[model samples]
Target: MVRCVVQSQWLIYSKHLPSISTAKRHSIQAFPLFAISGRGSSSHTLSADDNAKPLLMGPLDNVMPRHHITPKALFIPASSSSKEKILKILKSGLAQTIKAIPTVAGHVKAASNPIQEGSMCVTTPFGAVEDIFTAQDLTESHPEMDYDDLKRRHFPMEAVDSNVVYSLPDLMKAEKPVFLAQANFIRGGLVLGISLHHSFGDGTSLKTILQTWATCCRGESAAPTLTESTRRERLMSSETGASLDEFPEYATIPDNIAGYQPGVAKGEGPEIAPEPPQVDSHVFYLSAQRLKGLKDLASAKLEGSDWISTSDALSALLWRSITVARNLEPGDAATEDTRVLNIPLDGRRIMREDTNSYMGNMILFNNATTPLRNLLSSPPQLPEIARTIRQSISRIDEKYIKRAISAIGSVPDVSKVIMSGGTFGESALTISSWGNLHMDWGHVIGGPSERVRVSKIPFPGVCVILPASEPGNRSTEPNGVEVMIGLKSDDMARLMNDPFFASFAEWRCS
Candidate 1:
């Protein structure tokens, strides 16, 4: 067993087990993690010949955000072992996993094609293990908090700050790491935070990485073997170039918009509000029974032949509740205003190919719009609203996906294009469903995680649906669903107090 002593807001590991040197500890706290490299063996270095070549960027990859992805925090329950032992296991597993997916250990560089000037390419370098992972001793700082309390509350904002759970290079730097992970040793458990560059991959890709890492940590053989071609493939248009006239998703907007930057390429950075609004995040849980009732209510007015999925019903409920919470006055102006719901549609299914092992962004938005009056009526037209969302998403077929790919490829400078449907704010909501992700890490951590949270929501009017704690761990009905939503402070307050909303979703935290 390993012993730990707390002194001066730092953890001092016993001599029997390897301990981080004083210099190394201070360096971890003072400097950016990515800046500390080359401490590992020379074998970690990439060959000059291999390093000279760059991987091609997919059409979807070219239009993704270039900055760091919103970090994901996993709240593991307390275990019997010491924090040092857990950290060692996590780090070792991560090192092994990176060996299989080397692209994630690489850096994002500028694409060579002049026409695709704003796009990105990736290249691996030496000492990737040392540069991408770090551990911080937080037991001394948060001595009073325990696993149960932390699991029930919202993740502390300070824990998500730079150099704490993760770090990033200067925006203007020529290259940046595609993946980063940090382990925070708290009082009773650990918070393992992981971040991936938007250009590197999507949520599905991240899911694969997490599962493989868990398998490695469990000392299991037969962890999936992924090669460069198997993990990633360059996405191109069948028609060398296509026009955007048929694709309404990509548009050019004025610089005065909320996310618009003067010289920065469109879709390259997080959406920033000139004067940041007061937004609050809350997690709401809907039990299986409540979800079924909601679906029945939504389908009451639909024709027998018409069908609406459980996701469609849940999204419809959220959209109507949020709209009502806005408390728009009853008038022509309020009725004329529109509420847009944007749902991200994964392309793997539409392509009719087995891309379960494929990694990278393959997503498009399903824009569903409805007038405020319809959503805010005395008796809301829920069935119609749900049908609208369902139909919008159903429109995305293989042909449509290919056309979108071709249209995005036609852009000379991808940074100049923006989503034309609408922006995310008061009048719009963007919801992404991650309920299908396999989040069980108990095999390695000794117990299932009580909660999983995204470090932050990039903008207001955004929400993420997280998976249940156990896979198929249900009784009588499916397990409950957890939704993390970010909205203006006042709107969130009204939403929490709304009786109709409370009838279904139980508010867990701010």
Candidate 2:
């Protein structure tokens, strides 16, 4: 007998159970409700005063898109664990996580006046847990395919449809939950999709939440403490009196640019081109051996005392390879065409105060520009290109970050400020690394996730560095790194065939 419990009500149903009422069974079938036990139960019911108070939003949060964070899919293979048990565990764990970070349960409230321009807050209401979580039984409708089959197919978009993930319209609604999740159970596995509001936090915060939830699911007492000192104002205080001139990453754009919309935030979605190109997505895996060789080759070119990181070498390779694939004429290199690499730098450790655990946006974009001739030189300048990239990263110190924040605060309207380093387009590339995040869910599901994937890429000329499947194993180094890239169809074809690129990056998809 399968006993499903919701709050104080118990609804029991199974293939062999015939004594249950038709109406009660129908209700269970319509909505498969699960109860959240532990601390979540006590805080599930909010008081009138709790609902009236609004959570604070930092300055960085305001500039972020008002939509949901990019959705991520975690694939768990089939096991003896029943669907009810998994949902119950996840629900309880999520509820406890929300109890620690209450801001996630709240909804964003847009600013109505100039004073509140970059200080929008989230308002929490009662009974929001139900709206934040959902479960769907897709065993009959969609059976799980082989893991290798799914990977070769690049994980179809339909796998993360509205049935298992929140739609953009639903997320844009002001009343929707700041954090949303759905669990789809198929014939042979489970697909878990989770999304948080961009205004609520960044990738680090999401990692903390997931880690804490997993701990709780394992029947342990684990709850993160979000203190007042960790708020955005602490790091981006306008009282510092820093000047915007010191920050060179951002510039003012004229209002006459076509398709430029006023008051709309950056990263709201993918930028729409006048004539959009045909884009294709692919994943490339670089084994540890290849990465070491690439790093050694690039390091040999560096002068004494000058060094580059693994990330730098990899980025340099991609930059050079991508430029070659663009198919620019050799004579065109004489022109002043330059390729730009936009890298997001995390400001947690650079700050004087310890904000490593702060669950808000602390990321700033740093652009590295290279002339077409230098990148297309006869012999590859991997080391020189890497040094340039390293220099751009090293320039971002605590002082520079603070000044950047102050510059942002001084603007009359943040929506008008544009990042000088282009976000999307063929000439620019944005590479974001999430390889250091903790996403192991073996404790809850009885095994590690087979694969983790971004549901969709928002634009072309973008690449994401995903974390290793077994990141927690300290005994041995990571097997390799997986890079997901989206580029023009023709450019992708050229990249795949390029001997230099094929030598390092192994294509993982069909």
Candidate 3:
């Protein structure tokens, strides 16, 4: 039984307010992940790795990974001015987007290990933008926008299941970096959140680059780019690299699963669950002030000695949301003992320096556990629930990812009739990127909507947040963080209707 005492700081805020300013800043966009072969199969394999534990144990061999082309480009124009702009953006790490094939092709070519996994970011020799500016002008005119308030804006709060394509200026023969990010507005101003490929980089690196780019745009001091060796390459290792035969011990699916039916085996790919006929979708933008308020209130609820993060608070709320919805279902599988929260961990920190930053669909690892179960029952133990969240985050490692990848790829991939060249699919629930956005390209440079697909990401059951727009970054009074509780339509309805779930959520921000 976990006991949580509500601190005065967290107890004072209301749940909803008219303006984003009064509420916690939580503007989140949604994206979903879809396997190339979309269908749900029954045979499961849980991952046994420090970072990933959801993938079940199985004979995983001969799996060719998939790669999506970046919709944007990074090209320096041939003109001297354009070249200068490119240099400026690189020096400061912020350049106007120029979506083209040649530049990104060049980056793809630069990869030392282009076959399986590799990534590279470089300035094209030359590229032209609209008559207003050249790539070079962008480089020299200002530094990247490196402000905390600014950089954090360009990342999507939720990394879900769907494909994405960001904008790049359509320069004839000229190009710039094409990312999966878009530009938007904040408090009547422009912002950017480039939630690119999940394989390219981890959240920390992505966020750092966003800030660095903002600083570059603002003409601030430049941030040094990581060395090429460290910047990319090293994500792929031959099956022999780590003896792909070693599977984790705790990699088997349990006897019973929640929110799912029994024994329909397809394999380790996404099951094609029918989306709601009319899913209610909306994008909410958060202001900096509202976010801070939620954080403050959440902090107030904790002991002075305890430290928790906004992400932590939100995770608790969402987890509770799921439980609440499940409890309402008149199902045999709805047992309090069989729930788990799967967290995606970017194992970059755990790898060697050379591979740490290397990009290219490196791999998948998870950190998941049954969160504080006591909270959803009769009288919620809020503090204990918060502590459990704090503790669950403590156990994450890189070997888990490597091992999981090895195991995923190790499966013989048995198909009665094999396709010439294609991988399989598995139905899953994924959670990535919490509270991130991009306003620079969409709003900063100010381009047409066709220039980018603002909400192309489509991952079901995802939890996303607008970083700086949340309560911690902006708020003065007690309040809960403004977060988009994304779930399949059915899941959403159950969540809002249940009291324990909503109460669990309200307490998380405190």
Q: How many residue pairs clash in each candidate?
A: 2, 0, 143
Candidates' RMSD to native: 13.3, 14.6, 16.0
The order by descending lDDT is 1, 2, 3
Report lDDT per candidate: 0.63, 0.61, 0.32
Which scores better on TM-score, 1 or 2?
1
**Which parts of model 2 have CA positions greater than 4 angstroms off?**
1-51, 114-119, 144-172, 227-230, 238-245, 252-276, 423-425, 435-438, 442-444, 469-477
Show the lowest summed lDDT stretch of 10 residues, model 2: 5-14
lDDT of 1 by residue, 1-510 (tens): 112211100111111222222222110011111110111211132235554567656767766656555667776666787777777777787788776666767877666553454667786453456788888877888675456566546444334444565555556666777877777777777777777776767777777777767777777532443543223333433543345556545553333544345665433344432443667877788887898999999998787789999889999999899888876464544546777877877777676544445567777756788877888876777898999999998999877776676666666566544444343234656777763434455444655555666545534667777657423546655777888788888888888998988999997665
Score every model by TM-score.
0.82, 0.81, 0.48
Model 1 segments beyond 4 Å from truth?
1-52, 152-163, 168-172, 221-225, 229-234, 239-241, 253-273, 332-335, 423-425, 435-438, 442-444, 469-477
Best by TM-score: 1
lDDT (Cα, tens digit) per residue for candidate 3, span 155-249: 23221112222333332221223233433222212233243322233344444444445454554543333322122213333232332223221
lDDT of 1: 0.63
Error of 1 at 119 (Å): 1.3
Q: Which candidate is the best by lDDT?
A: 1
Write model 2 residue lDDT over 1-510, tens digit each, in one string.
111110000000011111222222110011111111122222233345655666555545654555556777777666677778888888887777666666666776554443433345666563445667788887776555444456456455434554444423363444445777777776567777777666667677677777777777777765444423224444544235444444444543345544666556443333332433567878788888899998987787577889999999998888888888775575567667777877877777566656666777676777788888767776788888898899999998866766566556665555444344432234666777773443455544655566667655534567777656433454676567878777888888988998888888988752
Q: Candidate 3, overall lDDT? A: 0.32
Model 3, runs deviating above 4 Å: 1-195, 202-205, 227-230, 233-278, 281-310, 329-337, 348-364, 367-376, 381-392, 398-429, 435-459, 470-480, 500-510
For candidate 2, the lDDT comes to 0.61
Query: Which stretch of 10 consecutive residues in model 3 shows the poorest summed lDDT?
Result: 4-13
